[model samples]
Target chain A: MTDCKLCSLEEYLKLIEHEEITYAQPHKPAIPGHVLMIPKQHVAIIEQIPDEEFGKMMVQANKVSMALFESLQAQGTNIIIQNGISAGQKDPHVCVHVIPRREEDGLNFLWVPKTLNEEEMSTIELRIKENLTVQLKPKEVEPPKPEKVTDDYLLKQLHRIP
Target chain B: MADMSPEQVEELKEKLKNMSPEELREFQKKQCIFCHIVAGRAQAKKVYEDEHCIGILDINPANPGHVLLLPKEHYAIMPQIPDKEIMHLGITAKKLSHALLRALHADGTNIFIANGVVAGQKAQHFMIHIIPRKEHDEVGIDIPEKLLSKQQLQQVKQHILPSIAKSLGARLQEQPVAVEQVSPKEQSAVPAPRHEPREVVIEDTPRKAQPKAPKKEHPKKDQTKDEDVTLDDIADLLGGS
Candidate 1:
């Protein structure tokens, strides 16, 4: 079995408890009020995450945003998540970046397009479509089921009053 | 603000029916009902809502399912809003698109945002238009020619590169792993494919091929017309040319 960094969903949730490792909470010693929202399941990309989980993630992200707004006195908040290497995802783990923004803070998020021509665009689109289509198809053979873990324990550990 | 009473809503509708375009524009300027809806001061049949924005039906719609996605906060143009806001807006728009697809049974939807005066932004308030389209419906909007020549496009790429690089550098400094660095070499190396014109052949039902035949030519002397018959002669004959 491949040793995936994000092996269990509960373990991943626990990682967020330590603000240093998870970076999903406000008041990290180094970066001020950086929050991350990730799926409880091992999903590589936003598209792969189930719709229900995606909705839950958004709600959590909103909560983080509200927290950041209140604590940091942030003018605005930026929610970003990179999926693959091409999209700047350094880690294989899927996570969202909730960075607080302030006026003239000099944080720029302009996408400098390397001007893809029609063919390159088509090729890239086709490649993405192929990968997504494969992922979307229902598996004929069921993979080994993950061990059932109680959500109460995970929730109690993850949620903290700050 | 409280919800309008039935009588009040009826009166409002009556007023709307009587009002001219100028009056409507003035009304919109003074206090936009849509803005009031976003601010939670007015009631609207909201299609979708998130923390940042809300999608509502266009009362006088171009189509049945036409909806406008307006930000809670007022921003005149796309550039004024940060990329994060744009991303959030996009996500919200995507959700709305899905809902519209399911509810309206639409074939597809056109998602467009008009920015600034040149982009045909009628209202001073910024909004995104999500027009739900049905098959064979006459939504007669012409697509304008916004294509740039290859040379012009290259020039634009050249012009924005410095600023893009600077911004990327600054962003990296702030959040080290925030952005993916894409090199120009990798970008330029990929070539676009060209499409060739296709030859179309149409089959006809049992048409007979005709054989060519020689034709006799008329004498050149007989073909010549008399130059003496002028417009004056026609006038003399029938008082007409």
Candidate 2:
């Protein structure tokens, strides 16, 4: 089993720079300067990560983007994450791709659409509408009773060296 | 020791019980403390509160003094919001913006609404981001320029007009009894009939003053002018490409 990478930011940085992790691109050599912000834990996808960790990841991603701007002189950047195979995820690791973009670079990533028949289109539309309606409908929920974890204890646990 | 009275707790519980499932989900996602605060389970730095909505300081702000305006009854996007709850969220955002300007001494502000996941909406709950903007702080928000053709612009205008009209119709329905009772004929008689949408009419009138006149002298001027206009604006005018 792959060990949890959460404790060592330095080790995580090294792995990102090593280029073997095909799922995430390293900041150096590829796009001149690009960074991949990822959870050190082996979380398969965003849905699997806890809410607090997810929020912290977002904050880190933002910080990395800011660093890219300052260091690389990046004019623009794109924050992308491929969740499932259908969304083009080749790896199971949950990571956010931070790609720095420049003006008139001809880096086109547009997707070409295949035409669908009228019946097929109608079927897809109907299915989506039905799903949305169902999702909006109310459901019973068990009362939310949060576990008592003090801030100090949680902080120490999160920051502990592996 | 209790911060809120028993009656206040009961009032909050009643509101929570009446909330739709979608609203509850939104509250769970966006207003993290609302559920905890309501249950007397968490303490939060509350900025503003009313029966329908609440404003609070964002724990992790894009900039200092960033505030979030959330509806007590949750809806994801502005379009999904009910007519009655319209002014409540918008007014709260406006008030917070003013407060940020006065208290934080911000240069400008951006009222951002990321509607869905595609739009970078992290929280499923409908929340308005009252981000206080500074002149030179690199926040990493980039707006792509899209070029559009004349035909696309016309198509978009045609498609959106009906939806805009429907929204206006819904708004009119919520007017006071006497105002609602007035027929289209009476309304028209009261105000001059305008072809443009009421909202558009107010904003568009200023543009008519600066009529485009073809300049014959400098050929370089035309090239520079084209460069000045953003590709996004062109794309918007032409419809999405």
Candidate 3:
């Protein structure tokens, strides 16, 4: 964990720093204005992140996207997450990539559509629907606790009266 | 229809130019088939639907089980979306990705958003493309890496850093992580604001907006029932220009 690059993002050019998320430039960017929104905690993948934290990350990502448009005058932006190794996640620590794109930026996020037979499509759909359950635990808020006034103060006052 | 007459094309362009931004947005929404799908005017194989979002099967998918999750509200680009909706989209994408991983027995998933035409946005309405992936799936999302020189990096930083700082104003109370490591004394120069203990955060309102109503989940048995034949071409045609 000590060696994780994202745990210590001090080397990178920092943009916006929140309590949970840190937006910074990649050491080797896909594009010039490309920045990464990384969680401060060492979460390996998206699944490991709490729902509220994930939502917070997205909020920050949108902010950075806006900044890309306003500050850099970027024509477009791609907010991409490469989840696992096969999806091109290099670091164990999950980071959301916000790349500022333009016409023919030489970036290839485009993929050719594969032809799936009816049976394959149906099976995939059914499987996903059956397993797709979004159980978002509502955020719990702690109520304010009133400060306690102890009777020990009265005894201390009596001693001081002498 | 692919080849329009020069005069006809010129006429359409002139008509478009005269419309105000609001009118243009309405025009874009009218032309956007995804908007039509959200409105229930167009047929779609919907996998999931909430008050704020709709997840539909992408007919022209990079991989099978590819889902295009969209906001119910029409927005041309990501920058136009409000923070609340953006948060909702993010959480929804995460849920969809979780489902894709578990159901498809896939190695991984990609949550991709194309914000503009240059970013490969085919539909004017912003949607997050959640694609389930496997090893050697031939889905080439491999972005070309460019290493910027020190001077070039500084220039890019100078351009964007201040605006982000200003936007985050009072929210940011600490120095950059890098700055803190190098000069701890300098951190003290910037007075820290008194951190207030946050009160009870009301649960987001949209969920309550449909509290008693059952979630609208349409799991279609017949994948091809009442399919709009022209639906497939709309994406192609809109992105053609």
**1 or 2, which is superior by DockQ?**
1
TM-score of chain A of each: 0.54, 0.57, 0.79
Per-residue lDDT of model 3, residues A60-156, tens digit only: 7777787777666668889899999888887888999988776665776899988877777777777777777444445678998998767798788
For candidate 1 chain B, the 10 contiguous residues with the lowest summed lDDT are B215-224
Worst 10-residue stretch by lDDT in candidate 3 chain B? B216-225
Q: Which is superior by TM-score, 2 or 3?
A: 3
Candidate 3 docking band: acceptable
Clashing pairs in 3: none
Q: Tell me the tens digit of each residue's lDDT in model 2 across B39-141.
A: 3376544565678776655555666555667776655544456545654555555555555554555665555545444345556566766655566544434
Which is the leading candidate under TM-score? 3
Q: lDDT tens digits, residues B1-241, model 3?
A: 2588989999878989999998988888888899999999999878888999999888889988999999998988877888889888889999999999988888999899888888888887889999998998879886666676655555566556655655544244443221111111122333322332234232232222322223112111111111211212222322221
Off by over 4 Å in 2: A1-162, B1-34, B37-40, B170-241
Comparing 1 and 3 on lDDT, the stronger one: 3
Model 3: residues with Cα > 4 Å off, grouped in runs? A133-162, B1-3, B20-22, B170-241
**Taking the tens digit of each residue's C-alpha lDDT, what string does model 1 give over B110-206?**
5555543433455667676655556655553222122333333223222222232232221111221111111111222322112212232222223
Model 2 gets an lDDT of 0.45
